[model samples]
Each structure stands twice: as structure tokens, then as C-alpha cells.
Target: MKLISGGRRVAGNDESTTPRTTGTKEGTPSFALPRGVTLLFAIAGGTAVANVYFAQPLLVTLGRDFAISPATLGAVVTLTQLGYGLGLFFIVPLGDLVDRRRLIVMQLLLLAAALTVVGTATIAALLLAGMAAVGLLAVVTQTLVAFAASLAPPAQRGRVVGLVTSGVVTGILLARTVSGLLADLAGWRSVYLTSVALTCALALALHHVLPPRDTAAPSMNYGQLLRSTLTLFAQERLLRLRALLALLIFAAFSTLWSCVALPLSAPPLSLSHTAIGAFGLVGAAGALAATAAGRLNDRGLSQRTTGIGLALLVASWLPLTFARQSLWALAVGVIVLDLAVQAVHVTNQSLIYTLRPDAGSRLIGGYMVFYSLGSALGAIASTALYAVAGWGAVCALGAAISCLALLLWAGTRRRTPASAAAD
Candidate 1:
């Protein structure tokens, strides 16, 4: 497919067409992004994305501290994810319209400020508002992903994406563990304060390290750019299918994490926040699958990978259902579930990036809208489900969602061309 950028057709499929300004002057040197720089981008992506998840393990504590019920505390995660979904639709498309380096830096600074607001919030309303801002600005993770994709060669795109996605997964898993430990020692507020410092430091480092480039500024206004994403969504069947998979898989993924804390914090388990957070370490094993998934996609196995991942997602709920009886069961389920989620995620991104290399930000942003929505649905529903019907309902909800994803994959897999299927 011909890649379009700024309403003009580019000759090749590679997305790294941003005109380099590094060697335009005497005594200047042109430098491709080294592995080290790419690794930094990965780290930055992880740190930025972690902000949205730090509250998961601390839900019970926050509920008590804020004098709210578990059902009401669900809004904290739901609103943050909701804001992120909105930002994916409204803000992320700007990456194609302006200087990405400037965009990322500015977003990071704003995220740091939002983190401070969350850290210092004394009332529930203030905390929820801050959380919304934090999620809104956290789209820097998408910006960095687009930046990394634009820097890598086509042959290495999947590998680079895999590595960066690994960082994202690591950030997500570790955020729970780290937040629990910090909150145990100093209180929940300290978690956000620590994030504020780290985010600011990373933002400063990125400003100096990112390379300079020029590109044709987009001719369309902001409204036109937003409208075009819908047009692109309508035009690309692969985009629609992959986004549906993201929505379903992520909904299942979120359902577990959202309510897992409640059961662990109560009854026979009676786990501490720190202990609950340790479960995230088990999930970290899934990060290993992300690298493998990327390599598999590079070898044209995305369809096969999706089928396996969906199967794993469905099976994971079985082990998770025994959480009250056996911690080991919960741990095993967490590992399998995370592996399945990341595998599907990496494959989906690899496929979408191929469809429109030039619109990496918009494509990723658009795709993640489904991700955010799924997460919000899961976050909001899991708590209420657990409160009303207990963990049984949560597991059933997760399994049903996984089954829907598998069915969607089966129905569409036959019609998707082999080339587009990458199988």
C-alpha cells in the first residue's frame, strides 16, 4: 500500500522519511538512533505508561483512606482510562502534524505536573480530577512509540517495537509491585510523588537525546485530522479487526487485575498490599513473550500468534477462578494471562504499522482507543461484579470476553488475505 503523509504519497513503505537535519551544516554529523537510544525510548515509554496503573494494587487502601466503598473506588481507574481513551482520539493524532520531539517533551512535563496533583490531592474529587489529567497526558507513551517506529528501518521495525513494548509491559507489571511497596512504607501519596520526580528526570534526558528531523507539516486542520482517523478506520479492515481483538483481550486482562486486589485483601487470603503487589512479578514473565511475539510477526506468523493468544486468554480464567483456594493458581493464571495479552498486543501493532507506516501515531492512537475503552469497561465492571457476585462473576465475565475474541478471530481469519494475515 502507498503510504500517505501530509496528504502526499511517499515512494516507499518505510516510515523513517522525516528529513534529517543533522548533516545539513558543516562539521555536523548524521547519526541513526543507536540501540542505546532506542532502549532509552523504551524506558521512557514504560515510565510514562506506568502512571496509569500504580493505583491498582492500592485500591483497598485508597478506599479506606478516602472513606469510599470498593465499588466507588473503581471510578479512580475507570476515569483515568476513560481520559486516556479520549486523549488517544483527540491528542495523539497531533504527532503527525508537528515536531514529535517537542510534542513528547511537552506532554511529559504536563504529566509530571499531573502526577504532582495526584500526589498532593487531599479530597476524593481532587484525586479523581488529577487522575484524569494524568491519564490524558500519559499518551506520551504512544508518542514515544511512534518516534521509535519512525527511527527504525523496516526490517528491524518489529524488533524495535517488541523491545519498546517489553518496556511498556515491564512498567505495567512493576508499577503494581513498586506502588504497593512504596505505599506500604510511606503511604499511597508517596507513590505519585516518586513518579513525579522520575517523570521529570526522564523528560529532561529525552529532550537532549532525541535527534533532530524535519517533515512537511500537515496541511489539514485539527478537525480534519481527527475526521481522517475515522476515514482510515473505515478504509482498513485489518485495523478494525485488530482493534476489536485489542478491545476484547484487554477487557479480559483488565477484569482480572482490577478485582484481584479485593479478593487478596479479604477473607482466607488476607494478603497485604505489598503481598498483593508481588503477584505482579509473576505477570512479568509475560514480558519475555513480547520479544518472541515480535520475532514471530517478523516471520509472518501474526494470525497464528493471535489464535494461540486468544486460546491462552480463555484458559487463564480457569486457574484464576481458584484464587481464594490457592495463591499458586492465581499466580499461574496471571503469568499466562499477561503472556497472552502481550502476544496479541505485539502482533496487532506489527500488523497495523505495516498498513500505514507514515501515520504511525494516528494508527497506534486509534487502535489504543479500543484498548482504553476495554480497560475502562473492565475496571468499572470488575469491581462492581466482585462486590455483587464475587470472584466467580469476574472470572465468568473474563472468560466470556475471551470467547468473544476467539470467535471474532475465527470468523475473520478466513477472509483476511494471506499477505495481510502475515501467516
Candidate 2:
């Protein structure tokens, strides 16, 4: 770890507590959002998520329409995922220094424009650009997470994150189902159009339903904020550990999602698009289970909870390896995978939020950088491996990654002094 002004490192906690101006005056609760803030957070998180995944179910149609090859078609998903990663690292810090609500609304507008452009684009290049734009704007999900963390009393942060995290999972699974259904009946363009409507509604709901400002006044410089993010990775062992775990879990998660299309829609399964998409529902149900589990974290159950969740995630992939013969097996795998992911994800955020309450935006952003990179790697690896070997290769690869993640968490035996610090 490199030294900064603080000698060893500046605590990320500093960033979490720092407030942004322009949203409201000090002592004015910048995000003093309304009583229904929880609902607002869920909607915001869900809406942003829908934008990021709108392309997942449509990749097939996109390839067909644009005459792009599979390797190149994967680029659409790859680039979009990359764009989201970039936003988390770059755009997310602004939430710590600027007005989060304002940033969210602006991002939504930009995302809406990106969707419209994507829906209208005639050329592959233009469509890719539009996809990137949408990906960039989709980082609004991080902002909403930060917002929820900030508003909740410290003790309840886990529950709030768990709830919003559920929205994200729902978006991930539902995007596939909705897009697949709409693309068949209406056209690929209709998917983006539906996103536009959701964005517009979310923007309105946020403005009307969110509370007044509550953030601490901002004083941190851009240099300080950047340094703060890096310092968190350097000084915080648990943050790094949890983040790595997330990367591994999500890699397997993304790998399975990205490759499932090949076996299910082709070869022995020969399933229809709608049928394939419907499988997402099973996964969504898993996410729902994980969300409910989040409530247990604050009750001295975080570690135990995460342990169970990771185990579930590891178990979830088993049925998938042999799932081609039976759709039921595939659905069971989907549920397990989703539950495992959401459980780990919710627990990860719950812990990270406590690390730096002030810089919720920056912290969430930093966390997501790793998450996005992991997802991208998984997606790329899944498709590339499928091309070279087959779904078995991808499944084996995913299983190995999942087991490694489990080992990483299971083997770690140290704990920081912070947990015992004053509650």
C-alpha cells in the first residue's frame, strides 16, 4: 500500500460521511427523502438495472439484425458491461461530492436517450455506441444504493441494501423475460421503448417521493475522493476480501447466464426464446429469498448468513451441469444460483456500507468496479469457452470459480478491530 497524507492511509469512512452541496444547505437533510424512501430506492435501483440488462435477451436478435458474428456479437454485452464498470469507478464518486438525486435523474435522462438511440440505430456501430451510453448511465443503481445506506439508521442498513439488491436481481432476471417476450411479439425496438417509459416514471417518482437533503456538507477535494477510493482497497482487509468473493461468485453467475443460451436454445433442448426467458423467474425467486435473508445480518448473523449463502451459490451450479436433459433441473439451478448471488451481494453491501457511511457513493462505486469487471470476464469467458469446447467446459469453469470463492471465504480466519469498536 502506497502512503498518502495520512501516513499509512486515509480511512474510506471519511468519504462516506462527507456531504455534497448544491442539493441542499447543511443541517437540511439533502436526501431527507420522503417516508416512502424505501420504495423509492427500490424503484430507482430496479429501473437503472433494467437499462444495464436490456441487451441480454436481445443479443440473438441483434446479431441476426446486424449480421454480426458470435464473437463480435458478444462485444455488445462486453462493451456495455465495461461501460458500467467505468461508470462505477468514475461517475460514482460524484455522488459523494455532488447531489445524488440530481445525478440520478440526469443519468436516467441520458439513459433514456441512449435507449431511444439504440432502438432507432440502423448501423452496428451506432447501436454499440447507444449500448455503451446506456451502460454508463446504468450506474445510477450504485447511487441509489448509497442513498439507501445513507438514509437508514446504521442498524437497518443491511435490510435496506437487501431490499434494493433484490430489485437489482429482479431486473436482471426480468429483463431477459420481458425482452424475450416483447422482442418476439413487437420487435427488439419495443424493449428499449419500454425502458424509456420506466425511466420517465422513475424520474418522476424520485422527484416527488424522495426525502429532503440529509447528506453531510461536502469538503473533500477530487484528489481526496480518488485517493479515498484507492485507500479503501489498500487499508481495508474485509472490503478487499468481500469484494474478491463478489468477483468470483458473480463470475460464475455471469458465466452461467451468458452461456445458458447456447444449450437451452440450441442442441438437445431447442427451447423457445420465451421458454428460455421464463427460466429467469426461478432465479428471481432465489433473489427474493436472499433479500429476506438480509434482515438477519444485523442480528449477529452476517457471517453465518454469508456462509450459508455462498454454500447455496456453490450448490446452485450443480444441477446446471447436467440440466440440459430436464428443464426442471435448469430451473432449480437458476434458483440456486440467484439465491447464492443475492445472498452474497446483499451481505457484501451491508458490510461495505458500514465501512464508509459518508462516501456511500464512492464506496459503492469502488465495490462495483470489481463487480462489473468480474461480470465482463465471465461473459467473455463463457462465450469464448463455448466456442472452443462446449457448455461442459463453461460449467466446469464456472464451478471451479465458485469453489475457489468458497475456499477464499472459508479459509480466511482474521478479523479487524473495528467490529469491536463502539457500535
Candidate 3:
């Protein structure tokens, strides 16, 4: 499959990432998306993405229920992330090849079924299988993002993407809090059951509300479609740089989230699940604050947004370094980290979508591959590091990753062709 550039197919050797300069002709329409549609997209994307994270706060409960050892409990999250990573490569690319609306609805329905398996599981094997299934179907979140990007006019794509991604970040950050509350009120199983009901409702609503659009059938087979996703990175320098930044940022993000409960639950504080979960609310506030990042990209200030956001990411660790002693400090660190991460994330998506409007799904799906990998790396590395050293070591690792991202952004911003930024 040929990559689309400026509404035309570019050969494999072409290095041009920017679409041709048609000025207002290529970047026209400037339509106002209904507030209701954008809200629905946000809610749907948030709910779908939340499925992968609901397990984080419930790992302790799950370990006891399944009689699993504390040392191996991390496998629960590992399996889910693995499934999600595989889905990003295999299932997300299908958005470009098929009816995205139907595809999204189908994934939701399957996701509901997967949640049912999880909520009803009586054995360890069943629970792991269900979690894996849930993760696989959760790629619907990315599909919703690509669909929203494709629906919006070029001028408004960044704003729409920002709004939808804010929903995604909200889901990811708040899932722990909500799951903690649900687990405290009922049990861990209730968390999955509740999500099952929510997923089904979202599927029906999306099917009804999502407007039917004519999508041309791709000429290439499914294998070629998957290959095209990778081909994009080789072709687009912007995608490559942005994806690497995604890896570093999310690694920093996962570092904080994956092991935070440990220090909170240990002897010094011994906070309850609900108390630790409340930290999510602090992170959610930061995520919402970053919704404006899309507008900044729309204003052609992506470089500034990225530089500032990455610096904030690095600075966030300073407060986190004091988390072992102070709750207030932990809250401040979480907010800064989440805000900076979301801002850079929104900027990354907005910038990449401009490179290939015709291949929206492929671009986002490809970009998110790095996101999954980074999350997995951070999750594993943080836990191991925390065990060997302590919370201080974990914070140091996160700071190092954040600093690497900032340096990479600085180096690339200087070398990126001016024409690419104008797009």
C-alpha cells in the first residue's frame, strides 16, 4: 500500500512528510464540530482506554483472590499490556481497511464480553485470559481517536484530537481511583462487571450516533496494510522523533503509576486502597488542564509546547523525590507529571495527524506502538528498581527518562525542516 501524501500516493523512496502546500485549499472547510459529538467521542475513548488500567489498583486484591504470590502479581498487568501492544500492531491498522464505526462497535461488544469473563472468573487462568482479551479490545480507544481526527476539518483536527485524548488521559488516570472505590464498596470483581455494563451502553450509543461515511476500500491486503504502518516511520522523520518521545514520556508516566501503591501501602504511610486511589484525582486535574495543548498546536507552537512540557516532566520528579515523606509533595508531583505528559502527548498526535490526513489510523496506530512499549518497560523497570533500591530510585529513573525526552526534543526541534512545522 502506498502512503498518502497531500491526497496523492508517494513512492516508498519519498522522504517528504509534509503534504504539498495547497494553502487554504488543503487546509480548508473550517467547520464547527457539534459539541455533543465531540463529547461522545471523548467519553467513548476514555471508557475504552480505562479497561487496561482498572487492574492496576486491584492487583493486591486479585493476588489474594487467585492465591498468587506477591512476587508474580505483576503478571496481571504484564499480560494486559502485552495484549494491548499486540492489538496496536494487528487490530488498530484494520481501521483504515474497514468501516471504522462498525469496527469500533464490534470491538466494544467484544470488550464487554471480555469484561464478563473477568468479572465472573473463579480461577486464576480465567482471570488472566479475560484481562488479555480486555486489553486486546481496548485498542478501540485509538480507533476512536483516529476516527475523530478524520471527521474534523484540517484546521480543527488538533483541537478535536486534544479533546478526545483528554478523555483518554482522564480514563487512564481515574481508573485507579474508581476501581479502588468499587473494590472497597463491593469487590474487585465488581470493577470488571461495572465496566461491562458501561462498555455495552457506549457501544449502542456510538453505533447510533456515529455518522455513516463512505470509506474507500483499500487496494492492499491486510498484510500489506500492517506493513504500511511501519513504512510510515521510515518515511516520516516527524513520526520517528515523536514516537521516541512517546516512549520516554510514557516510561516516565508508567514508572510513577505502576509502583506508587507500594510506597503508599508500606509501613511508613500504610494508606488504604481508596486513599492511594485518590491520587488519581490529582492526576486527572492535570490531564484536563492539558486539553489546551491541542489549541497550542493549532497555533503552530508545537515546538514550544513540547519543550516546555518535557521540562515540566523532568521537574515533576523533584517533588516526587519527597513523596516518601509527604503526601502533599506526592500530589504536586503527580499533577505536574500528568499535565506535562498529556500536553506532549496531545502535541505529538496533532503534529503527526497533519503529516498524513489520508492515513489517520495508520499514523496513530503506528505512533501508539511506542507508547505501549514504553509503558511496559516502565512498569517492569520501576517495580524491579523499587524492589532493589526504593521509591527514591524509582523517582531517579523517571527523572532520567524525562530528561532524555527533553534533550531529544531539543536536538530534533533544531534540525526539523521549517516546512514540516508550517503544516
Candidate 4:
């Protein structure tokens, strides 16, 4: 049997062929992934990614408990994002070179241990260390996404990736809500404890259910693998373009969510943590855009979707500007912002996966480096900007970032025939 990937025909019994080999020898065995398995991937991806965000809503309670100022507590979020970015560049590439199921299981176990440390930490340093470890191990989310892309057929890959990515977005949004409610019921430590339990359960479930891959592993060493990610960035034009877009848009996203709780906790609104967390549920409505974005990408409308998504992203900030006074405006902006971000994200992934099917993990890892950087920038900038100039400044910053992303898209459209056609 043979399969086509990245415009080349590779000899393989199924879709899971090694990246180096264009064709497999005779009698290699490969099997189709069932829909149940895909759903499991989605659930696992969501569960894993949720670990990175569980602390966002708990920062206030955590600050109070540790006697840390809000400004200093912002370091917690920034350091975690820094760890995640490091993991994206250094750890995620290993997915292409190892047995991904085993890698996934090991990472999840580590994640559980890290969560335990976080839940029990007495010192601020201990807690921050644990948070960084959690962020690092949370790259399991990307590994699972690559695994899903590898297992899916070409025609349906966009849809499968979209659904799994939707799980990721859902986890992110819901983590805030779940953490807030849990922290309200118990203490902030309880949030980490709950994550420990969930991570352990999911780890065990994945070990039992994830399909075995019979494909040959890549021959590259760890250093070589890491270097190749940079090489990939240089070689793939679409990858670079999409990654930059991800950076700008996610920066805008981080700017909004990173400081949203601040205003909600102050002034006329004076919402409880629980009430602020409930906004995640509102934002989740936007995640529904993931599936629709996937369908558009499948129809070759990724560039068109990017333009629209960026425009919507900029528009979302308008409503958010009034968030200090009007919760309704904030809610509307959250929904639109999440929808815009997820739509662009799904489209980006769909396009990148098509670029190099065999190297899906590396490609995704490289692309997500931009995501982590953008998120970190947003986390740091939002808190600082909010402190200096207030929510209006944050909104202005977000709107500016969104416009930059739109401009990048427009410039790309001018240079690339496919992008121009999409316009």
C-alpha cells in the first residue's frame, strides 16, 4: 500500500509512516483509527491542556494565601508560559522520534506528580517551580494533537484536528470556571489537588486505550531533532506565516483573559471569583467556531477565515473596552474573542498539518513556540498595562495586536497566489 503526504507518495500500509522514508517495505501493517479513539484523543488533549490554565483563576486566592502582591503573582503565569514555550521547542519534538503513546503516558504521570507538588506546596518558590513543571509537561496536549493528525486520513484530517483542537480550547476556557468553583468551595490548593486526581485518571485511561503505533521511529538524535525544528521554520513559508499570525492573535487573547479578573473583582461589578469564573462558560460559546473553521479549511478557505477572524478579533476589543462598567459588554467580547482566536487557530493547524504529514509533531511544536511566546507576552503585558493605564490600555493593546495580525495576513495574501485566491 501507499499514501500521499506533503505532495509525495510514500509506501506505507497506512497513514503512520516514518518521516524519513517515502515508502515502506512490503507487508508493513497499519490500521484505521475508530471515531471512538478520536474522541478519546480530544478528551485527552483537553484534559492535558487544561493543566496549563488551572492556575489562572486561582491567582488571587493564591496571592492572598502566600502574601504575594498581585504584580508579583503575575510572574507565576509568565513563568509557566515560559516553561511551556521551552517545552514546545525542546520536548515536543520527541513525539516524532519516540513511541508517542509511551511518551504521552510518561508526561501525564509527571504532570500528576507536579500537580501533587503544587497542591501541597508551602513555599512560594516551591509552588512556582511546580507550576513551571506543570506547564512543561502540558506539551502532552500538542503531542496528542500530532498523534490525531497522524492517525486521521488526509481528507478528514482537518475535521479531526479541529475537533481535537476544540477540546483544547474548551479545556482552557473551562479550567478557569472549574478552578474558581473548586477554590470557592475549598481553598486554592484544592484546585491543584483536583487536577492531580484528574491527571492521574486520564493518564491511566490513555495507557489502556491509546492505539499502538507500529511505525519506525525517526533516526535523529535529540539535539538533531531540536535543530530540525528551526530548520523547518526556515524551510516552510506557510509555517512561518501561520506561526506569526498565531503569535499576534494569541497575544491579543492573553491580553484580555490575563487581566479580566482584575476589573471584575474591583469597582461596581465586584463579582466574586465564582462569578468571574462563570465568564469562561460564556467564552466557551466561541469555541464552537473551531468546527466551522475546520470545515472551511477543508474547503480551502483558510486564508479567508484568517482575515475574518482577525477582523473579529479587533472588533472584540471594542466591547471589552466597556468591560469595567458593563458585564454584558465583557461577555459579548469574550464570546467574539474566543471565537475569533479558535477559528484562526484551527485554520492555522489545518494548513500546517497539510504541509508535512510525516513530521506533524515537529511542525506543530515549532508553530506552537510562537503561541507560547505570544501568551507569555500577553500575560506580562496585560498585568503591567492594567496597572499603569487600566483596562482601556489593555483593550488598546489587544486591538493593536489584532490589527497587526490582520496586516500580516493582508501582506501574505499579496505575495502568495493561494492566499490571494482565498481573498
Question: RMSD for each model, in Å, please?
Answer: 6.3, 8.1, 7.4, 5.4
- Ordered by lDDT, highest first, the candidates read 1, 3, 4, 2
Per-model C-alpha lDDT, please? 0.85, 0.76, 0.84, 0.83
lDDT of 2 by residue, 52-114 (tens): 776766667788998878766667877888999899888888888877777888888888898
Which ten residues in a row are the worst by lDDT in model 2? 1-10
lDDT of 1 by residue, 1-423 (tens): 121222222344443533232331222232344566677888999999899999999998888887878777789899999989988999898998888878888999999999999999888889999999999999899888877777666666678888889999988898899999999999999999999999999988887767544466678898998998898899999999999999999999889987899999998888888899999889998788888898888888889998999999999999999999999999999999999999999989888977877787899999999999999999999999988999999999999999999999999999885666756
Clashes of each: 0, 20, 0, 2
Candidate that beats the other on TM-score, 2 or 3, i.e. the better one: 3
Greater lDDT among 3 and 4 belongs to 3
Residue-level lDDT tens digits of model 4 in 139-210: 999999998777666657678888888889888899889878888899788888888888889888787766
Model 1 misses residue 205 by how many Å?
Answer: 0.8
The residue ranges of model 4 lying beyond 4 angstroms of the native Cα positions read 1-32, 417-423
lDDT of 2 at 397: 91
Off by over 4 Å in 3: 1-31, 419-423
Worst lDDT run of 10 residues, candidate 1, spans 1-10
Model 3 alpha-carbon miss at residue 38, Å: 0.5
Question: TM-score, each model?
Answer: 0.92, 0.89, 0.91, 0.92
What pairs collide in candidate 4?
A: 11-23, 11-24
lDDT of 2: 0.76
